[model samples]
Target: MQESHLSAAPQRTGNVIVAVALLVLMAVGGYFRFVGQNWDDFTSLHPDERFLMQVASGIGGPTTLSYTDPAGLTQEQADQRALCYERYPATSGIGGYFDAACSPWNPQNVGFGTFVYGTLPTFSTRAVAEVIAGLSSDQSWLTFYPIHLAARLVSGISELLIILVVFSIGLRLHGKWVGLLAAALYTLTVFSIQQAHFGTSDPMANLFAALSILFAVCVQRDGKLRDYFFFGLAFGCALASRINLLPLVGLIFVASAVRLLPVFARGVAGYEREAHWTQSAVGIILAGVATLVAFRLLNPYAFNGPGIFGLTPNSAWLDEVGKARYFISGEWDAPPNWQWIARPRYLFPLWNMVAYGMGVALGITAVLSTIVALWRLVRGKPGALVNAVPLAWIVAYFGYMGLQWVMTMRYYLPLYPALVVMAAWGLA
Candidate 1:
């Protein structure tokens, strides 16, 4: 025992050192992305950020309205603001391209798609911008960066946390070296790097998904009630961050159920010893309840449901639903002769994302994750079933993403954490 303890100490210390180093590296990467680029990045920011900025700015006419004074605008400044009201974020010359449509001001019909990612984050940043916007001393800081930068920083921090989660999950499954390897690859992944400096729900959802999977692992290993409850909360937050998490969360519950099934086989005898499966079962129930509460907490509009959901065809959520329907059908809006079955489109997008985004080495980990997970199930090795938690996420999520008709780098961000974890497992 003494020899084993002595041997483990250096490894533990190494894990700690690796964790700290990776944290600094990921943070610096995120920070530099925001601060590094000297050129006109404001115009290059995502349309979603631009839209949320206006909603928070009291200019875009958000349905979930909160009124603010053009807080710091001089008469001329206010007049210039009026000129750009309901217009694109930045002019075309800089980098801004789209002439985004303006939303009608209605507090009641804010829609599921709008607030699902949370009204609070954008509102908070906007409030900060209003204060700075009102400042008479400096005009340069008055632009969208004050508010936009906050959102980006929040996302950047979330990405950093995701890197840590990937490292931790990998370490749990394998050894410190592999964990470090997986995390190093994740930090440089294309999708992660692209969204690391942008402010939006994608990173938030990605972080929460990582948290959910982490907590699920805890529940599997220890069968602790809090782990189950925390897992539920994390999954719920993922949902609130974006509806895209729905399928992922569903798989988690299914995996949890499968993990707990042996308890049923064990009958009352399984309740003996140090492990308690019954309480863990209760904890899973609490996870469901917690999910509902958290969803409503983050986006109260979700509580209204159905007819009141998006309110109109032009509402943001209604528009999203239409897209989803089109997505499921896998059709493009091209002429009939130009169109085909189209499901194949989502596959290449998934493949290209994994191939280029993760780079050749780590991307193979993602591509092979499904095969390894299935092989583990077939082999029935020690901890093979325990691996199901992450496997559920890996298999279901990639399948879900691969079938969708539309794709983008941001859309692929959620897969990075799981990819790294599974890659670590595969390598081990």
Candidate 2:
């Protein structure tokens, strides 16, 4: 008993050391993410950030509780109260809660017609700004400078969460040392740090993207109902942050398929197969339901106004999304589209990722580790297939985005966590 106790002491000490190291790494990462949040001062030099702030600033609680007839109001008053009747005190009861148009949270009702991105990031930043304004009784927090800072702070917090998620993923895949290494590496990543300093949706979207991957891995490992449910929630949050992350939903199907393999093998061998199919099917269905519910809640304006179901389509929002896609495809003859005219598809993104975004060493290490992981899986190596969840996502996302006309660096933000994990795996 004494020998066993002495042997366990080192292990406990090691765990404490790891815990302390992780905390220190997180502190350093938080400092990098939060610093220089006000880099552009009050000028709002970044066009995307400026537009997002404009939409956020426009979103607020209704000033009046009484419903006013549209016919009695002037054009200005009508515009000011565009969907006022759809929201709270103006349209009270439990019905108002379900009626998205009347909720006062939808950006569409605020009169902005061209909101293309997901609503979660803008809503999150605005919520912070509103709290500050309410507490201080000073509307300055709702102004350009302070609001943008709030957005930046939110973005920073999201990235900080991402670092933690990356660590967890690495720990699951390898062990604590690999997790620590990946977290430290991601903490120092140039692009992540740069994005964290901006008041944009990219970091928030990236956070959800990382989370989806994490939960997908969890489902791959345990094949539990709750894991699938959480994966769906993360996927929905990712979709609500950026529609571009719609591809991440594929991870759910992949995990489900992997979970079914053992059952299929057992059946083929004439063994008594357990009733796992029903469980997996239920999990998948539950995941889908969770995804839709989360998306609807976070992005309420996607539907037409005033109902418990709120299932009717909003044609204006659909049209704006279509236009945004067209512009991104370089078919709109816009100024931003010109940059993609002669740019080679995959090479441009690859070059930027290696040279500027990830730095050459880490990028090369990730590529090599991914190749090694694939090779091991091909050889039927034990535990090698665990990498498939993230590897598949990386391939699918890069394959689709690399072919796109707009090869912006931030478009590849979702790939960072997986890449860092792979890099850490290689080094370990």
Candidate 3:
């Protein structure tokens, strides 16, 4: 017994060693991308920094600044403000591009972060920032870099974990080599690497989504109660990260139900001697409850207090929402719209079709995989849901982006791992 236990220790340690090495390699590759490609984004001071300073000024701070805006202000007032030096019309030289230059110190305008402030509560960054400030009594946003790194690192780690879980699922369903290929393909996929390098919420949310599915798989495999708890935690984390995570969440419950249905019927038919239905039921309930609570906690309104939930006043939200809707629906045109989907927009008659082409390619393959996986499940293949998780992930993600007025491969970075996995599985 002692010798057997000791032998097992080495295998466990080997697994840990391999996982760590893979992560170190991934980190090195991510660092290279960060320095080589995203160096501009990191080195260039955020244009919004000036805007933030202006916001800081109004709360009795010393950084008072002014900007001119012809649309919303009088000619005399617009001329006097330094930030508003160029009127909106003047900047429209290249399809109205040159007309909207604002004064560097103007604080009245809000961009992505501020515009989506109401959605902040459901994000982890604010909570992480609050924790740091409260603990250190430091108010500087620059000091928040550590917090940001921590959050990003968690996202990176989560990607690695997803690889491991996906590999295990593949190994259980197919074989060890298939598992390795799936994990390798996922790790090397272009989209996954890009998302892993960028410090964004999407990668972290994707990690959680992957884990939630993994846990659900375990439950379907008649895994322990602890697996359910973990599924709940991961589900909650995903919800907290992005509202787009809803479809993935819904899929988890549905997948669990679908898998469990046969199991329940089997138990009732005496096909199996005993079935732990109560434990499984409790796990599912726990996952749902945890996800709801996490969604509430991550909401900025919940963190900051009520009334602030909307971030902007009702009027502002309405205006922004209208713009956001238009921008998403393509009713409002953008100068560089649909460029990310395909290079050389001139090659395509309409830029919209370029994105559609990319979407169709990804969507068709995913749909086929889904149909195949479902068929396999009906044929009594174990771990069908587990193997299908990555395909499901990609399909759900593409569906979400399809609703947006604009889509970019970069934005779909989080779903890259799933894509790679699906491709690998299909090829293998």
What CA root-mean-square deviation does each model show from the true structure? 9.4, 3.9, 10.6
lDDT of model 2, residue 392: 86
User: For residues 1-428, what per-residue lDDT tens digits would candidate 1 score against the true structure?
Assistant: 99999999998898689878787767765664455332335674566776665444443333322222335445643443354453434431111111112222221222223333454355445545555656745433335555566566667677777777887777666667767777776777766766756767677788888988888777766667787788888877887677777776664465557556666654557345225455655777888887766765544343322222322223444454465556545465655324334436666666676677777777876678757777978798766786677777777787777666555557767777887777776776
lDDT of 3 by residue, 1-428 (tens): 99999999978887776567556655654553343333333342333222322233222122223333435656644453443333333532111111122322112222222333223221344345456667878755324234344334444555556667666655654555556666765554445554444445566667777777667666656556777777777777775555456676655555555555665553365534245455556767877776655544443222212222322223433454465456556566567465534443222322332234224444345345556776776687876656555556655666666556556444454555454455456657
Q: In model 2, which regions exceed 4 Å deviation?
A: 62-103, 266-274
Compared with the true structure, model 3 gives a TM-score of 0.59
Q: Lowest summed-lDDT stretch of 10 residues in model 2?
A: 89-98
How does residue 364 of candidate 3 score in lDDT? Answer: 48
The global Cα lDDT (0 to 1) of model 3 is 0.50
lDDT of 3 at 154: 42
Residue 198's lDDT within candidate 2 is 86
Error of 1 at 317 (Å): 6.0
Clash count, one per candidate: 3, 2, 13
Query: For model 1, where is the 10-residue window of minimal lDDT?
Result: 92-101
Best model per TM-score: 2
Per-model lDDT: 0.61, 0.82, 0.50
